[model samples]
Target: MKIVISDYKSSLNFDINYAISYLRDTLGTNTEIIVYEYNGNNKEFIDILNDADALITGYLEIDKEIIQSLNHLKIISIMATGFNFIDIQQASRSHIGVAVNQEYCTQEVSEHVMSLLLALNRKLKHYTNDVDAKGIFDYGTTNNLIRLDGSTLGIFGLGKIGRSVAKKAQSFGIKVIAYDPFISEEVANECNVELLPIDDVLSESDNISINMLLTNENVGFFNMEKFKKMSKRPYIINVSRGALINEDDLVDALDKELIKGAGLDVLVSESPNLDNHPLVNRDNVIITPHSAFYSETSILECQRIACDNVINYVNGNYDKMFRLINPEILK
Candidate 1:
C-alpha cells in the first residue's frame, strides 16, 4: 500500500521528515509515505497521489477534484481536530474516510488555556514587560488584575479540551460553567461545570474561555452583537480555532473597552498583517502565535497518534481514536 502526505504547511509547525519516518515504520516496507507541499497545485497533487492507497493531510484543503482523483485511496487522515478544510460531503460520496488527530493535544490546549488565564489574572506578562524596561512599578498595578479563587469561568465548548479545562479550573476554586449543545448534561454535571446558554455564560462569567471548533455554522460566532451581550465583560481567552471569534470585533472591543481583556493564542488567519491590525497596540490584549498545543510531550504524542491513524488505515484497522468530523464515511 502507498500513503501520500500533503497539506503539511496547512499544519505549518509539523515536521514532515519526522512524519515520513513515522509513516515508514508504522506501515512497514510495503507502505511508502510521500510529502508534498499543498499550495493549490492540482497537477502536483495528482502526480503524487497517482498510486496512493491512503493520503495524510496537514492543513491544505483537498477539494472535489482531488477527492475524485483518490481512486485507490482508502483514508484521508488529517493531523488536527478540525475538518473545515476538508469537504466532508464530497469525501462521503467518494467513500473515502476522513480522520483527524483529536485526542493527542486535549490536555495541552486546556493547560495553555489555564496558563493564559493565570498569566492575565496574576498580571505576569504585564509585570514582565515592566521589569524588562526597568523594575516592578507596583504590586498588582495592571488595571485590576484579579484572582481566580472565587471567580466564574465560562467555557464555550465542552468537548475533551473543555472537560479538561473544567476539571483543572475547578482546582483553582473557580466555578466552571459550559455551553456546548452537543455535550450531555450528565457530562457537564460530572465535571462540576454548570451547563448554560451562550448568552447567560457571557453575561455572568468572570473569565471566558473559548475552545470551540470553527465550522461554517460557527464562524464569526463572537461578533459585535455577541460582544454587546457581555454583561460582565470578562477576560477572554481563545485556545482553539481563531475563526470562531471576530478579530476586528475583538480589537474594537479592546479599543472601546467592550470587554476587560483577551489572552489569545489563536487568530482568524496566521498573519492578518498585524502591522495594520488593530489589536497590535493594546496593553490589555495578549497574543501567542497559535501555540496552545505546543509542549514537547504533546507534540510527540500528536505525531505518534497521527502516525498511528495512518498505519491503522494501512493495516485495514478502521477504529482510529481521533477521527472527529467525517465519522459516517467509514461505512
Candidate 2:
C-alpha cells in the first residue's frame, strides 16, 4: 500500500517526529507512504497525490480535481473532524473511503472552550496583558468581571464535547441550555441542560459557546442578524470550526458595541489578510491560531486514533468509533 500525506511540514518550527513515527509503524513491513512538506499550489503534491493508495491531510483543501486525479486512492483520512475541505460527493463517486479523527482531542477542545469562557468572563486576557506591560494591573480597573456561578451558559450544539462542556459548567453552578435538534429531549434533560431554540439561547445566555461542526447549511450562520438579537451582554466563544461565523461581520458588531466581547480559538487565518483585520487591535477580542487542541494528551490521542483508523480500515475492519463523513464507503 502506498499513501501520500499532504499539508505536512517538517519545518524547524514544528516538532512532528511522533507523527512521522506513527505513520511509519502503521504502514510497516514494506508498505510505502510518502510524506511531503506543504507548499500550496505545488506540482509535486499534485504528482504525489495522483499515485497515492490513501492520503492524510491537515489543513489543505482537496477539490474535485484532486479527487478525480487520484486513480489509486482508497482513503482520505483527515486529521481533524471537519471534512469541509474534501469534496465529499466527488470522493463518493471516486470510491474513496473517508475517515476523520473524531474522538481524539475531545477533552482538550472542551477544556479550551472552558478556558476561553472563564478567561473572557473574568477579563483574564485583558488584565494579564496589561499586567505584563505595566507591571501591575488592578482587578477593578479593566472591566467589571463577573463570576460564573449561577450564570447561564448557552451551548450551540450538545454533541460529545458539548456535553463535556455543559457538565463542567454545571459543576461551576452555571445553568446550561442547548440548541441541538438531533439530540433527544430526554438525553439533554439527563445531562441537566435545557433544550431551547437558537434565539432563546441568544437572548438568555450570559455566555454563548459554539461547539458545532460547520455544515453547508450553517456556513456564515452567525451573522449580523444573529449578533443584533443578542441581549444582556453575552460573551461569545467559538472553539469549533471558523466558517460558522463571519469574521467581517463580527468585527462590525464589535465596532458598534453590539456584543460584549469575543473569545475565539479558531478563525480563518491568511496572515497578511487578517493582520490588520478589525479584531486585531481590540483588547476585548481574543484570537488563537486554530489551536484549541494542542495539549500533549490531545496530540497523542490524535496521532494514535488517526493512524489506527487508517490502519484498521487497511486491515479490513472499519472503526465504529466516530465516522463523520462518507459512512457508506465503509459499508
Candidate 3:
C-alpha cells in the first residue's frame, strides 16, 4: 500500500524521516511512502493524491470535491486535534476513516490558556507597552485590576484541556464553573467544578475561557449579543478555533468596553493582513500566531500518533486507533 505524507517537510517543523521510518518498520519493506511537500497548490496535490491509499496531513482542507477524486484513499490521519478542516461527512460517505491525535497537546494548550488568562487579568501587555513606548512606570495606570484568587473563571467546554485548565486555575484559588452539556455532573464534581447553564455562566463569570470544539452550529457564536450578556464585563481568553468568535463583534466589544480585554491564540484567517487589521496594535487585545500547541515533546508525539493511526488502520487494528472521527466506515 502507498501512504502519502503531505505538507510535512517544512510546514510542520518536524523531520519527515522519523515518520517514514516508523511507517516502514511497522508495514515491513513492502510499504511505499511518498513525502509530498504541498506548496499551496491544491490542484497539483489533488492530482498526486488520486493514487494514494492513505494520507497524513496537518490542517489541509479536504473538501467534498477533493475527497471524491481520491479513488484509492481509504484513511486520513490528522496530526492536530482539530479536524474541522477535513470533510468528515464526505469521507464517511466514501468509506474513508478519519482520525486525529487528540492526546498530544492537552498540557501545552492548558498551560497556554493559563498564560493568556494571567496576562490579560494583570494587564501585562498594557503595562509593558506603557513603559516601553512612553517611559512611564506608574503603578496607578489602571485601577480595575483584581486578584484572581477570589474571581470566578467560566469555561465554555469541559473537555480534557478544559479539565486541565480547571485544575491549574484552582491552584491559584480561582473558582471554576463550566458549560458543557455532554459532560456529566459526576465528572464535574470530580474536577471540583460547578456545572452550570451557558447563560448563567456568561452572566456570572469574572473571566471567560473558550475551549470548545468548532462545529457548524457554534461558528461565530460569540458575537455582540453574547458579549452583551456578560454582565461582569469579563476578560475573554480563547485558545480554541478563531471562527468560533466574530472578529468584528469582538472589536466592537472592546471599543465599547463590553469586555475587559481579550487574549486570542487563533484568528479567523491564519494569514491575515496586519496592516489594517482591527485586532492588531491594541493595548487591550493580545494575539498569538496560533502557537499554543507547540512544544518539542508535543511535536514528536503528534507525529508518532499520526503515523500509528495509519499503521493501525492498515493492520486492521481499529481498536488501537486514536480518536477515530468516523467509525462507521469500519463496519
Which structure among the candidates has the greatest TM-score? 3
lDDT of 1 by residue, 1-331 (tens): 7877766453555556776777776657666666777666788878888888777765667888878877778777787777777888888888877878867788888889999888877777678777876676776556776678889999999998989998899999999988999999898888878999889998989889998888899998989888888888788999887889988888887777779889998778754467867676566678888788887777777667777776776566766545635667655
Candidate 2 local lDDT, 1-331, one digit each (tens): 7866666342112445666678777677576767777777656677887777777776677888878877888888787777887899999888887889878887888888888888788887778877887777577667667788989999998999899999989999999999998899998989999999989998899899999888889988889999988886788899887789998889888888888899987776522256567777577878877778777776777766766767766777775434637768655
Instruction: Give one digit per residue, the lDDT tens place, for model 3 in 186-298.
Output: 99999999999989999999999999999988999799999999999999999989999999999999999999999999888755678879999988789997888888888
- Model 1, global lDDT: 0.79
Candidate 3 is scored at a TM of 0.95
lDDT scores of the candidates, listed in order: 0.79, 0.79, 0.90
Clashing pairs in 3: none
lDDT (Cα) of model 3: 0.90
The segments of candidate 1 whose C-alpha lies over 4 angstroms from its true place after superposition are: 8-18, 39-43, 134-136, 324-327
CA displacement after TM-score superposition, residue 191 of candidate 2 (Å): 0.7
Q: What value does the lDDT take at residue 281 in candidate 3?
A: 91
